[model samples]
Target: MAWKVLIVDDEPGIREVLKDYIEMNFEHTKIETAENADTALKKVTEDQYHIILLDIVMPGLDAFEFLRRVKDLNSLIQVIMITGNSTMERVLESIEAGADDYLLKPFSTKEIEEILKCSFARIERWRNAFRNSF
Candidate 1:
């Protein structure tokens, strides 16, 4: 299956790392990057994305707010929040606010692969169910 992914982070390094890693590991994947929430939001509106890797802290708009807005645009888009500042409260809040998954910074590529596996499974399931429903 082909996947459309958006990587949203304020840092250039994080964006490049994720884009490169996903490109290297995942076949038939198209990835885009945005350095800030505003640009991310604009991109989201312009295209359909299957997955979003978002940073918690960004200038202009908060991550939670961006999540909310993105969810509003496409509830099916799987959003995974990535942050260096991990907290129980933030995790709970992110989940409650409709994040599909969470990951901490300094994470291994293996960890990202796991999350992507789960996300792909979930998306495939949803697609199947939708097809069956029709």
Candidate 2:
């Protein structure tokens, strides 16, 4: 099955750019974008995503708070925090809030591709183990 990925960013340019890159590079993935946290939450509630690429600073709800709220909503959903301002505090907060991974803004597409590859591999392993047990 194609992996479902949600890209949450307040900036339309960033969202579009990331969506295009993911779609072009990751053939086996479905990409969804949410401009704000509220819409992202609504999407999360309605569908199951394999991974979430969340912007740290947003208008309605910051990524940390959103991560806290959604962490328990879907146990299989892994989050990768994305931020332009990569502060030590923000990194620590994301880790403490249960972020599965993080990417600094202005990152290269190759970097993101690598991160997704690792994340998907881990997800596949978990799914395989679960299926085997059942």
Candidate 3:
């Protein structure tokens, strides 16, 4: 099965770029986009996703707040914070709030692809461990 990704960004261009890039390069993955945190939250609640590419700053309920809420809703969901503002504080906060990884804005498509690959590998390892425990 293809891994699913949810992308939350206020900018339509960014969302489109990510969606197109992922679709073009990654045959084993699919991506969905939401323009805001609220909509993203609703979608996440309705469907399971392998990874979430979330922007740090939005019109309302910024990525940090969304990350916290997502963790509260589903601990297994892996969130990868994406931001133009790459501050140490934001990175640390994202980690504290349970983001699995953080990517800076204007990052190369190759970087994003690498991160997704690592995320999938990590999830596979986790699944294996969980199955073994049963």
Query: Cα RMSD (Å) per model?
Result: 0.7, 1.0, 1.0
CA lDDT of every candidate: 0.94, 0.90, 0.90
Ordering by lDDT? 1, 2, 3
Candidate 1: misplaced stretches above 4 Å?
Answer: none
Say which prediction, candidate 1 or candidate 3, comes out ahead on lDDT. 1
TM-score of each: 0.98, 0.95, 0.95
Candidate 2: residue pairs that collide? none
lDDT of 3: 0.90
Clashing pairs in 3: none
lDDT for each residue of candidate 2 in 1-134, tens digit (9 for 90 to 100): 88899999999998999899999988888999999889999999998899999999999987788898889897668899999998899899999999999999899998898989999998999999999999
Candidate 3 local lDDT, 1-134, one digit each (tens)? 78899999999999999999999988878889999998999998899998899998998777788899898987777899999988898889989989999889889988998998898888899889999999
Q: Higher lDDT: candidate 2 or 3?
A: 2
Query: What stretches of model 3 exceed 4 Å from their correct place?
Result: none
Candidate maximizing lDDT: 1
Segments of candidate 2 deviating more than 4 angstroms: none
